[model samples]
Target chain A: MKELIQLIASFVGAIGFSLIFGLHGKQILLAGIGGACTWGVCLLTDFLGCSLPLAIFFAAVFGSFYSECLAKILRVPKTVFLFSVLISLIPGSNLYLAMRYAIEVNRELAMANAIETLTVALAISLGIIVMLVTSQIQARIKSRGNRN
Target chain B: MSLTSVREKDRMADAAGVVRLALDVGEQILLSGGEVGRVEDTVLRICTSYGAVRTDVFAITSLVFVTAVWENGEIVTQSRRIKEVGKCMRRLEELNSLSRRICTERPTLAEAEKAFSEIMKRSESSWVKVLIGSLLAATAYTAFFGGDLKDCLVAPFVAAVIFGSQFLTKKIGGNKFFSQALCSFLATAAASFAVAMHLGSSVDHIMIGCIMILIPGISVTHAVENLIIGDTIAGLISLSEALVIALALAGGFALSQSLFGGLLI
Candidate 1:
């Protein structure tokens, strides 16, 4: 429970900062939640000894579902919510580390890490595409039922 | 008031009235300027709570030019007629509860586009964007090969110059899509060249960083959204731009590889 509260606080903090930067409070909040959740899941995967690439991908999928659930509860755009969450998964740290490794002439390590980082980025983004696409189809079915 | 005016007032009240609340959330996601999409979502939730159906609420946010219409009501077009409902924190818990009562649906293309452009023009500072882009690219170079700030800075700087040129070119009546695509390609090529010249690292490293700076991943997200909502035309337009950018980057990478074989990765 304390962990959950901290996560919420961290998400709120990020959103608060985002709000200061001009993002809508609600969207930022949702994004913050998404980011925190994604971060948590990724950390969990690390602890579980899962492949970082696969972990990032599945975590992104988890984030999307989380976004969808929140969007349903909050009655907001899921895509907007999910996209912000994905931003947190951008491997910004990995990207940063890759640069440092390259600068140090640790070519082997740098290449390995870069590949890992890029793959993670790719996986997360791909997860977003898949989730949004599937949800689009689901929305269509709902709309059709409404019309009928 | 005249009896006729009273009738008019009744007609106005009965004429599918909408409830709007303008909550000043704060600056957007990137800390540049203007409130992002939170206002619209908040307004929608509030209106829906007060006996207004999701289809009855219409959000008009000035910063993003986003008029989010959840309900198919009488389309009001003015931005000034909107009013603030309450202070952000004052009704936070109530607002959250209210949001739960509202059932949200996908917004229209026009609405999404307006919001996107407004944020782009406001939330993102060009200088910061460039700085972040350069840092991202530099980080890539430093990670994959080996380089100092000098090496890291060079590629992103070249990228910023290219991107700036595109911005200028856009003002001069050139197509924004084409210009951005070209700019990304040039930026990537410049970084690759820097690597080839042994400026600091391998071409792949710089390219990795450069691509981060150049790719419109955020915009693509919006585009995907537009498509999902069945705004095919808008979605296609955004998709086309994204594709052009990808192709341009690939072309640049290929060209550099052909010209400087040592840098290919």
Candidate 2:
């Protein structure tokens, strides 16, 4: 039940961010669905006993792939979908906790939180890079085939 | 001889006009949160489509430089310095479409300028929508982060405070870093006050939710992506700016937390 509620919350969160970013019409709905799927993937991986960073990495991979495909279909820039879909995966909460811990003068806890935050951030970046490189290679191959 | 010179002058003016138009479009894309590569690509496309024999564009996060050569070997070079950046996906989409149209249709300079202004005029989001977006994002994120019902209920009001402060900061033309710090401070203080009054369950959860509204998640992600794609200079600039904003946010929250530590949590 908790997981289901979290999933719905992720959907609402993405829709809200899409509106904030001035996206309208069908784009907003697509962003919300994308955000929900990203979070669901993360939760599923976590449930399967993957580490937190690994879970987040898998979720980001799926999210970026979704954005790339949708951007091609809709004839829009990929950032439009990418920003809203990946909002839920950002390490905002952990960053905040790290700051709070530092302020409270707990060096150990602060360092741990900060490191966790950085690791998760790196995981997300690598995941997105993987998809981006793949897409670029695919485009190059198609162009070369057409040329031949 | 006079007639030939007059035609030459007209051609020179036309070449300059095309370069200017291309630069304007590229600048708009950068200001509307597009990547550096997109700005460069759009500028080059617009210039070539308008009969420029060769075009070169160099774009960073804060500036765009373009030089285009005409058939007669006249070179027109222009640049724009971008001071402000914003996130408006709608504007980015509209500008993308406009550039595509410009490339294919090769519209008159006057016609292209008119279309560009129309898009700018149409993309200003209404205040009601902004308020609702802030409210929903704050509340939903609170719940997503495991906040209870009371904490979620208090988030929208705190979110409103952050939005109002943000609007006022922009209106006064304050520094971007100052604006971010102010918003984070207000959000933290407001959330703590609400929880102190027994309106919310967890200060941590509420603070996290409100802070999400102020995080530079998009910028960080874009910065890393740019680095990976070999836009090293642009990526470095964006990354540093994101770091500064994150520092401001964290500093403001910490200050507020210290101030309210005695009252709660």
Candidate 3:
């Protein structure tokens, strides 16, 4: 239950933040929910001591799908939804830390942090692409059915 | 008419025509060794007395005319200015040359490849860029005072808030100044809470993360880019925006610290 509440908070935070970019309240709210669920998955994987990379990959893929669904239902742009939802998973701090390390001439630590950040970014980008492809397929099928 | 007298009159008319053309073509009347005051005074007078449309001009290498939208869907364009004639000629020549170049380049795969490479080069490297920025900030903090894992880990929230503010400010439809202020205050207060609640690892850690978020990275980047590209006026505008936002973030932090003095993390 506590975890669930935190997930909700994360969702609210993501949605609230999304509003700054001219996103509609409803659309952002849905994005927040999607982001929250994705974050929950990542948190759970961490708690279970599983590979974080894998968790991030899965979370992104799922997040994309949820974003697409919300976009369809809400009649907003899917790119907006997906990008907003993906915000929850961005390793914003890790990048900051890596920079700090480099400035201080801590080469080893900086390199290590930098590598991890790169991997996380790659995973998220891959996941988003996958989700985009899937959504396109779904859209194609929906359009085809309507024609018949 | 006396020959010398007519010659002097013609020179004066040509000078007036040059000024008019410059004003009409939307060229910055303030050019190399040009003075803005004279152009401004002339424009004001022309607008007031002659019913000529006076425009807000931006100074760069030349005066830039920036009247994209107008009242009641009507756009008033005056073409009698010499500046307008010069600008149109240059534009036409450029367009013709570009078409010729495109045609020639289409057949050369190497040229197309070079064009693509140039486009990619213009965009920043997404992965390495973020990584380097984070690494530098982290190392500075960590080396000054040994590692704090929890705080460092949670610092991203502050980063998020800073980044999030850009989006929030745009979406909220509030005054840009007010939105920035509110965002900074909320971001600092949130960072304080995150640290105090033990949810975030450390105060310093969170501050480092959140502080950058408010740093007008985009505006600063734009200012630098414009300056490097030789658009002095654009660079100035971007720099101003960056300065305002940075001050707003600082003000927000100061206010938060003062309000909850003893309770601050």
Q: Pick the candidate with the highest DockQ.
A: 2
Q: Which residue window of length 10 is worst by lDDT in model 3 chain A?
A: A16-25
lDDT of 1 by residue, A1-148 (tens): 5345434433543343233223354565556666677768876886788887777778888888887887688664454456446654555445444544665578888678667765765677667767767787999999999999
Please give, as one word, the docking class of candidate 2.
Answer: medium
Worst 10 residues of 2 chain B by lDDT: B4-13
Question: What ranking emerges by TM-score with the best candidate at the front?
Answer: 2, 1, 3
Q: How far off is model 1, as Cα RMSD?
A: 11.5
Model 3 accuracy (lDDT, Cα): 0.50
> Which sections of candidate 3 miss by over 4 Å?
A1-9, A47-49, A141-148, B1-203, B208-265
lDDT of 1 by residue, B1-265 (tens): 9975664444335322333222222112112211223444555453343333333222222232223333335343223332211112212323333344332432222343354444344433334533443443334423323334456557556656565765576577565455655665566567666655667465544555445445554445545555654555545665676556645544544444455544443
Two-way DockQ contest, 1 vs 3, winner: 1
On lDDT, the stronger of 1 and 2 is 2
- Which ranges of candidate 2 are over 4 A from the true structure? B1-12
- Between which residue pairs do clashes occur in model 2? none
Model 1, TM vs. native: 0.47
i-RMS, every candidate? 10.3, 1.1, 15.9
lDDT of 3 by residue, A33-146 (tens): 776888888887778886877788888888878877875675443444655466556654555456546645788987887678667766776676677667668889999999
